[model samples]
Target: MTVLKNCRLLPSLTEGYDQPTGDIIIEGKHIQRICPPGTAPTDSGTTIDVKGATVLPGFFDLHAHLMFANQDYNASVLRSQNEYMLDSMEYARVYLKHGYTTIRDCGNDFYVGVSIKNAIERGIIQGARIITSGKIISPIAKGNKSFGTLYEEVDRPEDMMRVCRNEVVHGVDFIKYMITGAVLNESGEPGEMVTTPAEIQAIVEAADSLHTYVAAHCHGTEGIKQAIIHGVRTIEHASYLDDECIELLVKHGCRSSLVPTLSIAFSLFNHFFEGTILPEFMEKAKDACEHVIEGMKMADAAGITIGWGTDFDRENFEKYVGLEFTSRAKTGLPNEAILRQATINSAKIVGLEEKLGTVKCGKYADLAVVDGKPDEDLTVMKKLPLYVLKEGVLVAGTALQQEKSYE
Candidate 1:
């Protein structure tokens, strides 16, 4: 048993605990009870006073690529495969340290993600609760392999079910398909639809047969509409979303969500004139950067279910990982609503709402402690959390900052 004493609760992010200050009791991996401050028996368990700092449920990232060796496209492919595994493990630990206790890793090769997820479950590795996808499924286009690629190649729609079944057999939790080209791929056009409607149907059908859902990497307006019409559950990086796309999401009744990735766009704008970026890559990056935030604003306005994601890579991880908070705040939405995207909304997206999103009893004891109230100032998230706990085990601490900056 463990008791978190004198903790300030964020009402917006909590349920079952309504008091402004209270103590949370933990038994094994679940929050056992909530009582008024100092009312619980402190007889036999460890007790930690959080010194009145605010405690919130740990955050989530519905879209994260956990196995990249570096931020560069070429480096991710050219680096030694052994080194990639090491880096990916370290990335998981570091991300947990940043207060994200749950993540759905978008893709990796060799089933590395599923392997590490099993490792974490076995207590051999310290990291988040990982839900992962197998190798990216993409068409045999130059964009999928301009330099070198980790994607599993396919051409005809007939091959989709077989490829998806192979990934499921290898232990992936879900299917990730490329509905449109990526900006970082040198030979690809970012907003152009590359996968046909038949391909989408095939992948979705395959995933449904396996009792899972499909998450698509989409950026173009037309492709976004196609994905919604075809029953894609989660849309990653809907950077070009428009009115018709919003209408389709509302009309479908399928509860499809928009996961806008603001980190990539913010990173592009941050490093636009660095001179190391290629000209073609810069052009596509510019297009995605220009419209993603506005797209998020538009989708939010239409009562669309907007979830949280930060398409972070190694290079910009530190600089822009938490930029999603400030970026969503720019949509003129309340700070509380923006915070919910990373918590409850994301939980609903992954179908884990009752188990993970709030600071309530009977839920897993996954949480983060910070000095400031994140509800009032979302930028406070940029700092590494003061204390992070995953399933009642304290995983990260020891970093303290009197001052921190975006630079």
Candidate 2:
């Protein structure tokens, strides 16, 4: 048993916890009790004094490509398989150390995400809890030689169903399907619809049968509406969402949430030069960056659920993940709302709300203790956590000393 004492707890936006400063008792992997500071039973368990740091639920990233390196699509493909896997594991540690305790890998090539997920579960590595969508499913375009190994390409509804089932059989936590072209796909435009409604529905149905959900990679307003209409669980990178698309999202009860990956667009537009990325791609990235913030404002106004996602690779992971807080703040979202998106809202997106995302009793003891109040200034998250805990075990920080007295 372990006890964290004298920490300020962030109130849950979804489930409220009244106390501001408290002691959290962890029995095994779950939080057993939470009480005012100095009130926890002190007879036997170890205690660590947090010294008034603000404690929050461990952060979650709804859309991440864990196996992809931060290189151009062509260059990323040339990496050896072993190098890719090792880098993925290293990236996992990077994310965890930065305060994200859980991540949902949107897509990956060669089932590397599944392998990494299994390794983490088996205690072979120290990293974030990973939920993986084995490989992305997309429509095969004829003569599209630029298509890499990242996708399982299919055209027919029946083919979509087959791939969905295969991914489920391979132990995927969810299924990811492309409803439109990607910014990085050289053969198509980002806003162009690539899959038919029937195909998307088939994929959704297949995932539903196995009790999992589908996350659609949609950038255009038309594709966003199609995905919502067909029951996709979350719309990723809703870059061009408009009023009608926002209405469809709200009407559908946001069982299909929106995950606007502003970080990718922001990274591409500001950090890269003309020749580093295709000029057309850079142009689209600029457009996406503007449209995403506008869409976020509209979605917030319409009360549509929005979750945090970076869609970034290893090289930009540290630089971009926390920048999401600043980006959304530009959309006029309150810092508290942004915190909820990263914690509770994201947990709901991946269907892990009850077990994760809040610092209440009975939830998993995954949390980050920051040196300042993030509820007021989210930029504080850009700093390494003062203390980080996953399943009640200290994974980062030097907060605890062997002989430090709790009193």
Candidate 3:
């Protein structure tokens, strides 16, 4: 057992915690007790004097491409699987350092995320608890093909199902389907919807039988509505969700993961604002941002569940939660609501609520400790966690004395 005394806990939910300044006793991998400060037992296995730090549940990033970012950025021209894995390892380490104990890897290249998830589970490296959606299913020249790599070509439902089953067999937690075009396509414009409703239904059915959720990468209004009707668990990059699409999502219980990667937007819009970005890219970027803001406002007003996911990093590697929080706030979502999106709500979206995402007893002992209350000043949310605890064992910072290093 481990006892963390003098902590102000922010329990993911907006409701106030039972113990604002109390003690949390963790036994094995679960929180065993939360009591008034002085009531904690001193004879436990480990005792931490938090000095009244704010302890919130570890954050969760619902949509991310794990091995794509570093591969894209670090690769001078081209990269092999072996080279990609090397770069992915660095991302995994940084992911843990950034206070994301758990993440849903939306898509990846070279099947690296599948291997990384295994490596972490087998204690090969220190990384986040990853739920993966291996290669995305989309039409030719549509999905991962845009990256010039990581493409998986499928032409039939059987082919799609076979690949989906193969991904599950390879230990994927979910399947990704690119139902629409991307904003950054090189074809002078984001093309039309690529995957048909029948194809989407096939992918959904395949995942359903395997008991995994499907995350659809879509941008167009019709594509978004189709993905929702077909029952995708979460919609990523909803850059153009019209009222009809929003209503369908709500009517069908669809959730959205808003990836407001303003950094990328700013990158694409650099020319318009500072006359640096290419003029053509500026219009595309402006349209994407405008649609994204409109979609976010619609989602927020409709009371649909939403979470943070940024298609920011190369290889869709991990990112700091603080930056994600700040970027999401620009989408018109309140900072406090965004916090829940990062934690409990994100957890629920990815089907990991039972294991991670909150400070409740019986949940994983994933904790993020900061110097101040995140509930107040969300800007300081990513201040290097003073300490990180996973499964009741301190894993970073001063907590390292009790941590088991994977290195």
Candidate 4:
């Protein structure tokens, strides 16, 4: 048990935290209660004085690839299996240190995500809670095989179910399937819909049988409707959305979250604009920015929940993961709305709102104490958290914790 005294709560993250400063009572791994400062008995556990700090729920990144070591697509095949697995283990610590206590790894090479998830659970490592999918499920295509075991290619539409179930057998939390081609693929259509409705249904059925869900990787409007209708739980990178696409998403009640990865698109375009990237990738990035921003506004206007995720390389994780928040602000959303997109809204998208998102009683005591009011100043997000707590325990931070033990 731990008592975080003099804590400040963000209104959006907590339901009834009316006080200017309160004490969070954490027993075991859950938040037992929140009370007025110095009101709770102090002779029960360790108490930390945090009077001026702002307490917010730990951030969530719903779309991530823990094993992507290469930011450059063409040269990605250079790394080995062992290298990816080892680097991923180290990257988990990075996520926790940066105040992201929970992350849904969108895809991975073969089994790294699952292996690392289990390792964390078994106490073999100290890291963020990892929700994982197996190798990416894609149709048979030349470019799909370029990333080694990162992709599990389906030879025919009928094979989709088997591929999805195979991932379940390997102990995945859910399935990640691709419905459209990507800009980085060496030999494939970037925006074309590759799978039929039947294929989508088959994958959905397989995930449903396991009592899980499917996350569809989509960058265009062609298959977003079918994927949502067929029950893809989350839509990754719906970069190019049309009126019909937005309509269908709302018509379906927006049950599926639209995770527009702005960091990757802006990163690519910025590098190209600065003459760092090759000529071939310039046009695609430019075209992606125009459509992605437009789609984001349309979704926001329609009241659709926009899940947050940053799609970037492993080596550049620290440098670019924080960019997603600022990039989201550039889309015209206020700082409060942008912060919600990363916290409560994201937890709702993954169906774990009851346990993970807020600083309420009975929820996990995963939290970050920042130096300023995030809702007023968005750039504060880019800075390291002063202190991070996971499951009622101090895990990582730079400041000295002046903890007092009660006898």
lDDT of each: 0.82, 0.82, 0.69, 0.80
Per-residue lDDT over 225-251 for candidate 1, one digit per residue giving the tens place of the 0 to 100 score: 999999999999998988888889989
lDDT of 4 by residue, 1-407 (tens): 78888887777778656776789999998899999988876786777777768888888888878876656554555667787788778877788877888889988875888999999889899888999998888887777876776888875666766787789889889899889877667655557887888888888887888788999988868788888888898999888888998888888887778888877788776772344345556567678777888888888888899888887765666775368877787788778788888888899998879988888989999998887787887777777787788887787765644442322
Top candidate by TM-score: 1
TM-score of each: 0.94, 0.93, 0.86, 0.93
- Candidate 2 per-residue lDDT, tens place, 1-407, comes to 88888988777542445878888888989889888899987778777778898888898888988875665666777778898788888888887877889998998877888888899889999889999998888887542445357778888888766787899888898998889888866766778899898898888888898889999999998999999998999899999999999888878877789998877788777755456667777777888889998998899888887898988887777655477776677788888888888888898878888999889788999988888888888778677787788988777653544444432
Measured with C-alpha atoms, the lDDT of residue 358 in candidate 4 is 80
Q: Predict model 2's lDDT versus the native.
A: 0.82
Please tell me which model should have the higher lDDT, number 3 or number 4. Answer: 4
Q: Which ranges in model 3 have alpha carbons more than 4 Å from their true place?
A: 11-17, 69-77, 142-149, 188-191, 255-283, 314-321, 398-407
Model 4 residue 70 lDDT score: 54
Q: Please give the RMSD of candidate 4 to the true structure.
A: 2.5
TM-score of 3: 0.86
